[model samples]
Target: MLCCFALSLVACATVPHTGRKQLNFVSDKQLNSIGAKAYSEILKREPVSENKTLNETVKRVADRIGKVADETDKPGFEWDVRLIDQDIPNAFCLPGGKIIVYKGILPYAKTEAGLAAIIGHEVAHAVARHGAERLSQQMALQGVGAVGSEIFKSTDGKLDEKTRAIIGALGFGATIGVILPYSRTHEFEADRIGQTYMASAGYEPEEAVKLWSRMSAIKKPPIPPWLSTHPADQDRVNKLIESSPDAQKKYQEVRDKIGLGVQLDVLMDQSDRQ
Candidate 1:
């Protein structure tokens, strides 16, 4: 059974953000549930920000970026944005269109443009389906461990609490630890998409570079991006500079169309349906 499963693992998988090809053991359905579950748990643990102004700010900026994710071919997402009152300078979007932004990131994301960068990055994660993708990779790695008991074949056995916990933990580590930091490639890809999204939403494309410069400077204790799996500050800054022209053009086009039509409303409504 292990040998058969090993053979089957050779087939292709898609990296969420980059849409690059890779091997994945976790099924799309499985990964999605993992994200949905984790997101549900997170929402329960964290308090939703009731600051009406801040919530509106997050929603407005997130809405604009969502409208601008065309280049990413963003699947219709339930565009609900919540500002959680936590000081963890982090934000993330789950596979099922759930987005959470912690209060700590507010300072780093000063202006709306700065916030756009962060939103763009997180939304890029959802667009690329990075959470699901990472979870799938983890399931595959877990498969290697399962080789001992041929446990994967015994679906009933594998679903036991202990086994399920191990698998769940693997998926979590992939998303939070490995995938989050190691997501530079995903980050770079998200950066491109986010930049375009922000630009299309009337924010300057050049702001991404500036945002990263400040972001880079904020490492009270510095760590290597590649080694840590986060993006390299210099690399991100350089790419933003290189792509600003295209981003700027996209922004102009988006600006002209902003408030000119009701297409985005249709999108938001559709998100509710899904």
Candidate 2:
């Protein structure tokens, strides 16, 4: 068993920027192909925004962030960004570089710099291959569960009720102890790398801190950090603040700085008027 576990470590990959080692048993080509197909299906099913200005803004910000990501990691993702006319305040980047931003997120984004922070974070998730890493972790957990089942089998090769209950408890413990925490780790890592990406792309890194502050103020019931997939909003804001100095240095080095850039609310008001 020790030798087998050691052998699995050979499949570990290092995350860009962070240099954290991650297990990745999944094939990148297969995962990216799946991501591309899912992105295509989402485009067909979701309402793609027809608002020219919003679409342009999403593309522009996402492109700049994506460019930085590509240059840094050189993953060669076929990057595309689209605005979805939905009330959801969220954005995500699929494995092959499909970026989707919902219209509702604009108010929170507030400015191009804010949007860059958001997109940079999502792009970091893709560039770091978090999706594949997550899938690999799940597969590893399932394999462990299967092995446990075999070990706890009764004399007649049946799973006794006690054994089944124990297995279920172990699975629950793993979910709470291992899986959920790793998700929060991913979120924090994404925030760190995303802030850097925005800064490198010539957007002010402080916008990330301000953006999270806005997020923390939203009047929603909160889940405890241990129970949640994301770190608490305040915790995230604090982390961004702590990392701002480094990101700011990157921003300072950029030749073409776009500090805060265009105010998104102004564009929204104009769109509403027109």
Clashes of 2: 0
Give me the runs in candidate 2 sitting further than 4 Å from their true place: 1-7, 144-182, 219-231, 255-260
Scanning candidate 2 in windows of ten residues, the lowest lDDT window is 170-179
| Per-residue lDDT of 268 in model 2 | 84
lDDT per residue (tens digit) for residues 24-107 in model 2: 766667666756654665677679999998789889899889889878899889999889897656566777888878887788
Model number with the top lDDT: 2
Error of 2 at 95 (Å): 0.8
Q: Where in model 1 is the C-alpha error above 4 Å?
A: 1-19, 70-74, 144-180, 222-232, 257-274
Candidate 2: C-alpha RMSD to true structure equals 8.6
Question: Model 1, 210-244: lDDT tens per residue?
Answer: 87888776565644222233444788888888888
Tell me the alpha-carbon RMSD of every candidate: 8.8, 8.6
